[model samples]
Target: MIELDNVSKTYGSTRALDSIDLTILPLRTTVLLGPSGCGKSTLIRLIIGLIKPDEGSVYVEGELLTPNNIFALRKRMGYVIQDGALFPHLTARENVSLIAKHIGWNRDRIQNRIVELCGLTKFPVDALNRYPAQISGGQRQRVSLMRALMLDPDILLLDEPLGALDPLIRFELQTDLKEIFKTLGKTVLMVTHDKGEAGFFEDTIVLLRDGCIIQQGTLSDLVKKPADPFVTRFINAQRSPLESIQNKADSKVF
Candidate 1:
């Protein structure tokens, strides 16, 4: 579990986060939904200790997350960035086991963990020796996910993990991700600009705008009981093909 208390961060004149107060539920997924520059990614970085908040504090499992304890607390959480961020020179196996190797995990242990992760992520064993360029975008993301889970982390942080894939691949991965999350039952924090993606996850939704939280609730709550005018506007902004047609029909326009 993670908590942000009265947190604020700024870059030059831009306020990345403004007095955020949140508590991440244990063994549940929480998606940060918003447009770009809405501070969704910044919030993730703050939770992972990639950057320190200019004001207030971050806590993990009831313990304060400070410089002294961040590294330790961070290890308990796994992070997968956009595009997977895999190393081109390393094979998928090497990449997934990189952290384990660095931490002096014995070969048997490392291999065992890698094998387990491959199965968990549904990655093929035959592809283990392939480099990032040798795999599909979805496979690369799977590799990234495997690497994140190598340590068996208690929490997972995903920043637009499926954004780069094609629609079909993205949908497939979405289903797989949902199943994996349910199977593991770890605390999960994900970021996405896509309302559909947020709804597909069927988890807690935290909608943000202009570096501040606009609303936090289930998708149905947001649809029927918007906390602000902006929330309704944001929700309406991302429309499916059916919704688009309905909107045009409702207006009697071509």
Candidate 2:
């Protein structure tokens, strides 16, 4: 449903993205997986129409993502950045219902949507009444997601949504997020530096380096046949030595 045709973006002497041509399918999670300084976030911003491409074009659904059409296009997509990006002054419920209220939704409809979103995200009912500062980091992330999904958008863009949480909380959120996606069946484009997270959460993974796509495929495709030594090493490093131990144990038991 989204296509990037020969797109490029430059900043002074450096190119953040160079002739990047990619298409993201609907009703599936596609991950932009790469290390820092790899231009993943730049791609996300371009798709969101936050910045114009230096060349080519970005198309959402079928329309060109231009200034004139960006407003209406954005309303059909949801985005969650690194931090929860919640309003510190507003309660969780307030944050979620803010957009609906802005669109002139009545109290009853807004309240019902808030309730439904909270239930869908499994955010605690009591936490909805508290300000952002009153909740834990994980809770704040959930609230951010709730806010993004509040509008019931067709596409979801998540930029390292669990990047800042503690390891334990991060793991929990990852599983919860996967379950939520499976249940909702919303098309998602998630950008993350964590290879494990990308492999575990995505149906297809696109590996980028220096503003270009190096490889894109399923987890098995990447692990068994990385495009080059760099990708091979990158994927190998993420596999723990404990995997050998588990293999040996399974062999003995079987």
Candidate 3:
């Protein structure tokens, strides 16, 4: 659904993306996995037209993404950031309806969409009147998702959507989000540093380092045949606390 051809982006002397080529398939979840400064967020910004590539081009479907068509094209995609990015002054309902209202959606249509998204994200209807500060972290993320889906975009780009939540809440949202992705079947490209999160949600995992793709494949493929030592280390370097405890119990080494 999206394609990047020889894409490159630079800030001063630092290159964020270097001669990168990637194709994101339709109706599937793809996770961009790497450590900090690996250019995952830069790639997302390029796709969203938040930042233009220094060289090469970005295409959504078949059309090139340029300044002239960016505004219209962005309407076909929904974005969510780590902090929910809600306007603190607006109520949750208002936040979700911002885009619809901007595009001149009638009251009935806006209300219906808000109701539908609240149900889809399991957000409390009564809480819709509350401000972001009045809600829990989980609720804030839900509100953000509701806002993103309000337009029913063809592609979803999430940058650490659950990164700020507590472990339990994050796990809960992860499961629900996977189900939602399956049900909607929209093209999804998410950036996450967590290996477990990538394993859970990714149909394909694209591993990057120093602004270049090292390998792109399933979790098993990455584990069994790492493209480089760094890939293996990145995959095995992180383990949940529960998994660590279980490993100790299994080995009787504690």
Residue-wise lDDT of candidate 2 within 229-251, one digit each (tens)? 87887777665669989989999
The candidate, 1 or 2, that scores higher on TM-score is: 1
Q: Could you tell me every candidate's TM-score relative to the true structure?
A: 0.96, 0.93, 0.96
Task: Write one digit per residue (lDDT tens) for candidate 3, span 1-95.
Answer: 99999999999988999999999999999999999998999999999999999999999988899999999999999999999999999999999
Query: Least accurate stretch of 10 residues (summed lDDT) in model 2?
Result: 232-241
Candidate 3 runs further than 4 Å off: 246-254
Model 1 C-alpha lDDT per residue in residues 133-153, reported as the tens digit of each score: 999999999999999998889
TM-score of model 2 relative to the true fold?
Answer: 0.93
Off by over 4 Å in 2: 239-254
Candidate lDDT values, in order? 0.93, 0.91, 0.95
Model 3 root mean square deviation, Cα atoms:
1.9
Point out the higher-scoring one by lDDT: 1 or 3.
3
Candidate 1: where are CA atoms >4 Å away? 244-254
Name the lDDT value of residue 178 in candidate 3.
95
Best prediction by lDDT: 3
